[model samples]
Target: MRWTALYARSRHLTVALAAVLLCAAVLPLLLGDSWSTVFATVTLGAAVAVAGVGLSGQDLDLDRTASFRWPPRRLTHLLVIGVVAGGVMLAAQGLADLPIDSSWILRDVAGLLGLTGLAATLFGGQFGWTLPMGWAMTAALVPKAVGQAYDVVAWPMATADSAQAWWVAGLLFVAGTAAYTMAGAHR
Candidate 1:
């Protein structure tokens, strides 16, 4: 009885997280550019949450399937979700009129890395592959996020510098890939 109650609670939490992700993805279309980037960031962040929830759910399911379930499928599913979610978020952000320079892209990439890490942690926990990936991805995103936040909120409002930002973003991309590769090495 206690176990069943816990299962129900987890299921409810999953539904709630999914709802939040949907709202995050839709905010940009609902309002104008003034709030678009922030909305997008929130939505992407929520997406990370959703992915984490999914990974946890998957992990729990595998516990039940310990008799025969494989881990590769869960990992693959996570990768696909990351790719699709990132693509949609990027396309939506691009459609908006917010600064499309390098810094903006860096922030987006950082957010994407964070989301990927969250997803991996949720789904790949059983295999001991997600922690490092999640940690590295989170690390890569923080600097860019900080820079973007400073430009947007601090005094002397700095302008977006695409070139330098893009370079940073590119470096992050390479680092993220290496982390991912290391995470999946055993698989």
Candidate 2:
């Protein structure tokens, strides 16, 4: 029983950490080639990280009969958090004299929602979710690492969307959630 409880706790922690690492890894790619895009990615990443922190921190609070007072309130809280994150980022950009504008906040919100949709699909266990999530993470991380390695091995080559990269990322995300679900059952 003790070991089982320990495993559960550890698994939850692992998921939260994975969430952080995944977002951090993807932030660079999601930034693409625009200052606004970079700011938006960073902002959304921060918001998601914050949400993960909140959810993970309250893992034990699952016992609460009312985890949320109401569904709309839950949405409200998320929006409030997003606003705070965007406002904070904007303030920092202003102080630093970065060319970032507040208009990017809307884009950031949309990107954050897209990421959340992907994450939710992974968590909700539809179609081989487990393997894909893990694979997606690995796929995302491997390219950046390879880029660094190639710079050392050969002349720096500009990265482009490769066929293998797309397949790996897509497959991993779709299958990883399934893998996660299977792993959850074993625990």
Tens-digit lDDT string for candidate 1 (1-187):
6644554364354564455446434655566556634444455544544544433343454445545333454444445445554555556556654443434533554534543443344345332324323433344344445665543222112234544444444454455444443453121
| TM-score (all chains, Cα) for each model | 0.45, 0.40
Best by lDDT: 1
Q: How much does candidate 1 score in TM-score?
A: 0.45
Error of 1 at 63 (Å): 2.3
> What is the Å distance of residue 62 in model 2 from its true position?
4.2
Q: Give the TM-score of candidate 2.
A: 0.40
lDDT of each: 0.44, 0.37
Give model 2's clash tally: 21
Candidate 2 residue-wise lDDT at 5: 58
